[model samples]
Target: MLFAPLSELYGRTRIYHIANVGFIAFLIGCALAPTLNALIIFRFLSGVFGSCPVTNGGGSISDMIIQQHRGAAMAGFSIGPLLGPIIGPVVGGIVAERLSWRWVFWVLVILSSLLSLVFLAFSRETYAPVLLQRKTDRLRRENINNNINNNAAALLRSKLDAGLTPRELFLRAILRPFKLLVFSPICAICNVFVGIAYGYLYIMFTSITPLFEQQYGFDGVRAGLAFLGLGVGSMLGVAYFSSASDRYIKKKAKEAGDLAADDDDGDGEEGMVRRRPSVGAIKPEYRLPPLRLGAVLLPVGLFIYGWTAQYKVHWIVPIIGTTIMGSLQLYLVDTFTIYAASALAANSVVRSLLGAVLPLAGGPMYEKLGLGWGNSLLAFIAVALIPVPWLFMRYGEFLRKRFAIENL
Candidate 1:
């Protein structure tokens, strides 16, 4: 939350660098801490600072890329984080087995430090507001240097006068996410759906170990191998979404063009009126198609996975179910998050919050219900909410109109 506001207030590059440094420092502290309390405190602090990337990543996407091309960028961005858990255990196990647990923190610090340097060196300021402010300053300085005491200079100065003060932008940036949560029904609803999906994913992450070990009599390495199915499925899912997303948008645009041609009169103005419903202006709801598909796949996959495991069916059967569920989970997470950002300004705070809270509920939930009934319970709730994306897709414009939130 703190990082989100700061990134918006200033710019992404600076926040990225600052956060990265703080994150690395905390990692070092975690590695060197003599006491568990110190390690725990440092770990908590590291998480707080480490969140800057995800919080600011969407804004950077908006700044640096056109909407049509963002699918690929978002897909690439989504892959790294989504794959971490699947890969983390595999590596962490080896590292912990071979070296002390402190080595885990030390190794991460080393790798992250190198990555942070690359990011700091390569990344430029991409936030539009920040870029514009810099441009305005440059123009003003150049004008003064040239002694261009004319209407142009006066106009530029007036524009600068009307622009937001640093204090004002800071306040707005900090408050915008909260405002959306309170005032925007779409944001609130979407956040809930995404959070549930995320929580369920984390639940699987925690429960998979015990499920394989106790239920299937699998050892540490084989149990770890179970996550490989999810990793492969998630990669395939990303491939599906990334490969088709841009094409889908273009196809919709082409169809919209055809419809506009049919509605065209002698003049372009009337045609534009008719074209409003078409892809001349792509709506945020375009991001939801994958989400709509995900709603169906998520529950069905969960049911199959859970029941198949419960019944001690062929091991491959449950694995296949997880593969499907894992793939769909990635698609849903990416889509819901991107859609939410599109629907509400500075709403990445909601994503950050969702990411943080979802995993915490998984362990207890699995403990109580066990793998079969626990996942089934989740599937039931998920199935019940399947209509959510559809409803938003169909009536989104109407809801947006009625709610009438400004600058959304």
Candidate 2:
């Protein structure tokens, strides 16, 4: 939350560098800590720094990818984080067999360091405003040296600079995610919906280990095999969503175009006047239908997994449930264009809060309610949130323009 907005104020590469360095430092702390308290603190700090990539990735995609291709690009980017929880246990199980718990952090530290080096060597600044700022500087120097004043860059420079002090600009930058959360109905509600989705995901992940161990009598490296279902499910979700997402959006866009063409006379049934799209050429709401399908299926998946796990039914059934849930996520980036990073940051703030705290309830909740009822509770909440996607797809464009974030 605090750091994500700085990328827009500074540059994506600079923020990446900061996050990479901090991630390595705190991860090393986690690796070296002798006490559990110290380890927890270091882990917390590491997570704060580690989130930069996911938060800023949407912004980077907005800078580089065209609208039509972003669905595929976003899916590719999304698969890593979604798979991380499911895959982490597998790697951790292997590392724990041969090495201490600290070695897990050590492994991540080594990988993060190597990735940082590559980023330092090759990653270019992708923020358009930041690039413009650089060009404006060059233009200013050239004009100063050559006695050529009032260049075209000046107008843009003025608009960007806005005579704000650095402190004011920083405040504005940091506050934007919160502003969107507070003021933008789309951001707030979508984030709440995302929070519920993420909370359930964490609940399932946390609960699965013990459930598998108790029900299947799995232990040692074999226990890690339980998470294989989640991994397979994540991959399946990735493939299905990536291939179908763009196709669905294009279909919506074509339908919209046809409607506009038919509305050439600006008539509606009886005396009702049709509300033409007031946002961009392709409404962002076009991206909502698939997400709606995902949302509806998510609860259904949880119900299946919960009952199957409770009954100690065939192991594959719960896995199929996770597959459904995984497909339902990757929600934020698909919704916004320019402020994708801020949008994601807003979603992440709520998501991380629920993700962290909700799982604390998992052990107790499961103990009391048992697997079936506990999961049913979560599923029930999800079912209630099903209306979010439907309403957003219906009226999101109106809300987006009504609460548009201007000139930040």
Candidate 3:
């Protein structure tokens, strides 16, 4: 909420800088927290501020990267969140065992602080509106006393003034994403599959420790290493899909005659038609292809990981299976996030709300069912949702036509 609105208001660079500083401060607060309550407070605040990257990273990518290159950029940006869970616990466990839990926060505080300073020193403003505003400011100051014609400056000034106030801007920023998520069937269905995939990922992360330590007789540090598979898989997925998505979009655009000529204004509507691939086309099914592949692999991985670990089969078997699952999971997330961003161009808020809620619910679901069964159940649900993206991708344009949301 804060990220999207602030990015539009103060610009992405400003928000990124400010949020990083807040993140460092909150980390320090967590380090020095004297009580559980204080720690929780600091952690929650850090999460609120830390959300800046998750919320605006896509928008930032969209701002600078053309549709053809956004997939790769998004994939690269997505690495942090994907790897954090795996890396955080390993480092935390080691630091806590060798030093203390306080040191964990202390270390993070120092690192985050250093990174924040670096970003502040070097990060450039990427939001076009903000950059344009800066130019407009310079122009006004230069022409304050001149009677020379300045239509461009006058028009830009009017536009800047007509821009939404901070309060109204923030309200619309927060509400619009929700409105899209609620009304856009394409967004809604894809969000469900993405949400489930994410929820299961978290569930698996929590469950892995017990499964490894108790079942395999691995110690704490060794058990933590199991997460390395997830990290590796995530990185591989990002590297592959990031570039793949961009190429796929470009290829589809060319096939659809949406590719604009060099001298053209780049305002043509050709590519939008290809955004949802035709059912009979030789083109890859952009929306559902990743989801369908992930859906099939996720359950298979779960079954293999669960039953093998349950029966004390070789550790390598489960590891291999989980690795495949992890990679596919990351791919699913990257694809859906990009898809949602594209479909709900102006409404990112709703995408994030659902993103936030699904993870919270995953814990409860896992707690009620044992790890093996819980994951298996999630996989089963994923199977049902696999076709949702396919349906949307095939019929989405028609739905959009009937609903006439473009006018809205």
Candidate 4:
């Protein structure tokens, strides 16, 4: 959340560079820590600083890509975060077994440094306001240098940006997400939904070591390889959603084309038609899986994965279940494209907290309730919330208009 707002308030590139440096420094701190306490502290700091890219990434994408084409862009961008888990387990297992546990931090440090260098060479500030602020600064410099006292554009920009103090901007960056989360039902529900899915994924991560190692008696390397099913599932989810979202939007646009007059700046989901846009707007529900596919598939996936793992069914069966549940929260970006940073940051808080805390309960829950019942409990939660997206589909605009955050 801090980084998300900071990127918009300051320059996105500057925030990334600072966060990268902080992340690397903390990783090095972890690699050389003298005690477990120190290591834990360093690890926490590393996560805090390292997450800057993800927090700001949605907003940057919003700045660069129109909503019409963002789904495809997000698919390519999401591959890293979604598929990243597959790499983490394998890399950590190999590095710890071959070298030492501390070497894991060293490996991350090296990779992060390389990424930082790449960003330094290529990454540019993508936020529009910050770019304009830079232009304003240049105009100020030029006006002063040339003694131009009555530059209309410069005066207007200065007046427009007049109360934008650093402290005020910082507060906006930090507080806006919370405001959206608290005041906007759409934002809140979406975050909670995404958070649960994210937490479920982490819970699966915690389960993998024990579930595969003990149940199947897999060797260490093979246990790490257990995550491959999920990796494949994640990729499948991304591919299907990307294609489905684009197809759905295009179809909706074709049907709504009569309402569109030129519609040059019309972003499909935002306002696809200029004439009577409210009636022709592509609803957020259009981004959802048609016929409640995601709603049913999520719980179904949990049931299959749980029961299969419970009864020692064929590994492939569980993999197939995982494939069904691996799909997750991409539509929120489309739902609030201009405020994508605040929107994603809202999820960041819920998802990060849930992702961290839920896994801690995984071991005890699985031990007490066993895999089948434990997963059934989660599936029950999913089933209960099935109406969330549907409700939005039917009444999202009314709710959005009625509870508009700025009004509050």
For model 3 the local lDDT of residue 395 reads: 81
Question: How displaced is residue 18 in candidate 1, in Å?
Answer: 0.6
Q: What tens-digit string does per-residue lDDT give for candidate 4 at 29-136?
A: 999999999999998999899888777777777779765566767766777776777668977998899999999989988899998999999998887667877876
- How many residue pairs clash in each candidate at the backbone level? 0, 0, 4, 0
Score candidate 2 by TM-score against the native: 0.88
lDDT leader: 2
**Native-referenced Cα lDDT, model 4:** 0.75
TM-score of 1: 0.87
**Candidate 3's residue-wise lDDT over 212-282, tens digit each?**
89889988878888888788778777766765666666677667554333425456656533343342332
Worst 10 residues of 1 by lDDT: 271-280
lDDT of 2 by residue, 1-408 (tens): 666557767889999999999999999999999899999999999998998897778778878987666787887887788888878888898898889788999999999999899999999999877888887778777767534445556666666566776678788777776888888887888777778777888887788778888987877566666777767766666666666767877776667666654334656554444344333666667666667677787889889989998998888787777777766765433443222445766777788898899999999999999989988998898888778877887788888889888755
The ten-residue window of minimal lDDT in model 4 covers 331-340
Question: Who is ahead in TM-score, 2 or 3?
Answer: 2
Q: Give the runs in model 4 whose Cα sits over 4 Å from its true position.
A: 144-163, 262-282, 329-341
TM-score of each: 0.87, 0.88, 0.85, 0.88
Lowest-sum lDDT 10-residue window in model 3: 273-282
- Residue 319 of candidate 3: its Cα lDDT? 79
Best-to-worst TM-score order? 4, 2, 1, 3
lDDT of 3: 0.71
TM-score of 4: 0.88
lDDT values of the candidates? 0.74, 0.77, 0.71, 0.75
Give candidates' CA RMSD values in order. Answer: 3.4, 4.3, 5.4, 4.7
